[model samples]
Target: MQPTILAALAFLVFGVTVGSVKIVNQGNEALVERLGRYNRKLRPGLNLIVPLMENVVLEESLKERVLDTEPQEAITQDSLAVLVDAVIYWRILELERTFYAVEDIETALKNLVLTALRSQIGMMKLEETYASRGQINQALLQQLDGATATWGVKVTRVEVQQITPSRAMLESLEAQRAAENKRKADVSEAEGTVESIQRIAKALKEQPNSQTVLQYLLAQRYVEANLSLGQSANSKVIFMNPKDLTEGIADFIGGDEPNGGGDGEGPKPT
Candidate 1:
């Protein structure tokens, strides 16, 4: 054969051989349309098709994909506005229906997600949204899956990325939290103080000569109060009554009681 004719034949054969087979990679699927109508689905690996009579209508990945949605604003049941955003995880469940069942799957999905988010948020209060993220995510997954089932899509999960309130509302929430914590701390400290006082009273009742110990404790507390006055934010250096301040200290030092019990070295009755 002539060299030019042989080369032409070889080129034609190679083109036809390459066009006859379609390579569908792993984690992917392809849909074949025959005579401009629905046909069979090709899964991962090599697939054969009639090159002249048919073509691949759609190709999609079977692997899970992520969609990061833009931030959306929604009102809570409390009529509070919050900015919400989410991430969606999805996969193509059926290749044939994925192409035929929906015109624009992604747009449909985006809208579906946004609507679901708004609806869910509207059913909850603003304060509940922060703690109920898992509930919101689960609700989104269920709603998305149900809506997209006909489209042959599976919504694996949804994650609420951010749910932020207005700066004023956020500051108010933080202040409320701090106030609640301080109230709880004050109550706890008061309860502890009461408990300690009760314990000390019981000990004093059990001892026959606990007056001297009580005087010493009172003097110590007086000294501590004097020392801490400078540390108090709202404290002023007001002159306190000298008589009231010296009452316990005189008893703690060697001053005799009215009953002349100046010798505080006696063994206490336990």
Candidate 2:
């Protein structure tokens, strides 16, 4: 009878020990409840509980967690349809609220993020969304942080993974860019031609005595014209020495006689 009582007492002690124990993992916190009411939170490492009156309700991870959201359809201010995807980085800051206040923290967070993204996207144009990804990310983080504060979740960062426009919009943008580029090229070409002509005219005006330059240019034009005639037999040919022609024209216009007397007639008559 004495051995039986000793063995029963040992079994009771083991059962109490097993039922009153709790272990919290690293970077985690365990919420303890007593008599179905709010109670203290257990920090990382081993903790004790009352055998039957106290209960371990929930465990909250303190480590940063990544939540990748599904791609959502959004419309821009410019009436463009876009598909946007993003990710959120968060962690539980207050273990008590995280475990007790929110029924489903992860789902609530995801919904909050989606709502914020749609609001932000709706306010921006398609081009703005693409160009201002940083702004979008910041806006998302701020909005999510505000919404999750009550749930004890801290949003560390939010990042936009991709923003894609519809096929029709992309094609329209490409066409617009191509047209702009072509217009620029044409304007540049026209400007270059105008500059070349102006430079040539200025050179000609500055050097009025440049008959040699004029003759060279004329000869080049003649050669090009002849080549373009393509073996035509009826092409007319005109030829003259530029220096002689220029001197003759100057003497005629100035009413000046030739330098040398012809046949010595001038000396005899005088």
Candidate 3:
């Protein structure tokens, strides 16, 4: 009977020693609640507590954590829709407040980030959103850091990952850009045609026989046109009369010379 009592006492002592010891790893913290109330915090390494009364309610890493949010649809100031997503880097500063202040820290932080992102995007045009990534990130960091301060969270960095437009919006932008380019091309071609006509008229007025000079230019243009058609791989060449091209030039040059009217007639008295 004596030997059996000694063995029972040894087992009890061993059980108490094991239950009182708590081992916490590096870069981690644990909160202890005594009898279902606030008690104390346990840092990294071995800690001692009352075996049954004190409970380790929370134990989490204090290191930086990353939160990557899903892509969210938002509207710009110009009323264009865009898909925006981001990455956040943050960590807990005070474990006590972090555990008690917010019921769900991660969910609350994510919602705050989404709200702030939409607000910032809503204030800028779609074009500005594409060009202002750094500005957006900095603004988010400032807003989130301040907002989460009470929750014992420190937002270290924020990054806007991607801002993408819908397929329809992309197509519309392409069409707009193409129309602008075509307009510029048309203006340039019209200007070139005007300059060429002015130069041709000036040269013809200086010639003694403007009709002959105009005829020669018409013939040259006809030859060049035929040559271009012959060089084209897919062209079906068709011959045109050079004389038909000369009539338009003839009318253009017939009016007057630099010195006087080509008809050698003075102005008639009314």
Q: Please tell me which model should have the higher lDDT, number 2 or number 3.
A: 3
Distance from true location, Cα of 35 in model 1, Å: 2.4
> Per-model C-alpha lDDT, please?
0.83, 0.80, 0.89
What lDDT is obtained when candidate 2 is compared to the true structure? 0.80
Off by over 4 Å in 2: 167-270
lDDT of 1 at 225: 78
Question: Which residue pairs in model 3 clash with each other?
Answer: none
What candidate 3 gets wrong by more than 4 Å, as runs, is: 25-27, 33-40, 43-46, 52-54, 63-75, 79-89, 100-104, 126-142, 156-179, 226-240, 256-270
Write candidate 1's Cα lDDT for 1-270 as tens digits: 699999999998888788879999888889888999988888888888887888898888888888888988899999877889998888888878878888887888888999999999999998899999999999999888789999999999899999999676678889999999999999999999999987876775456566656667767776787888979889887756644654554453324553224454665799
> Candidate 2, residues 1-270: lDDT per residue as tens digits?
999999999999999998888888988888888999868998888889997899988887799999998998888998888888888899989988887788888888888888888889999988788899999999888888788888988999999999998677789889999999999999999999999877765675456454455557766766786677757888776655655655554343223334211332345564
Separate clash counts for every candidate: 0, 0, 0
What is the TM-score (0 to 1) of candidate 3?
Answer: 0.69
How many residue pairs clash in model 1? 0
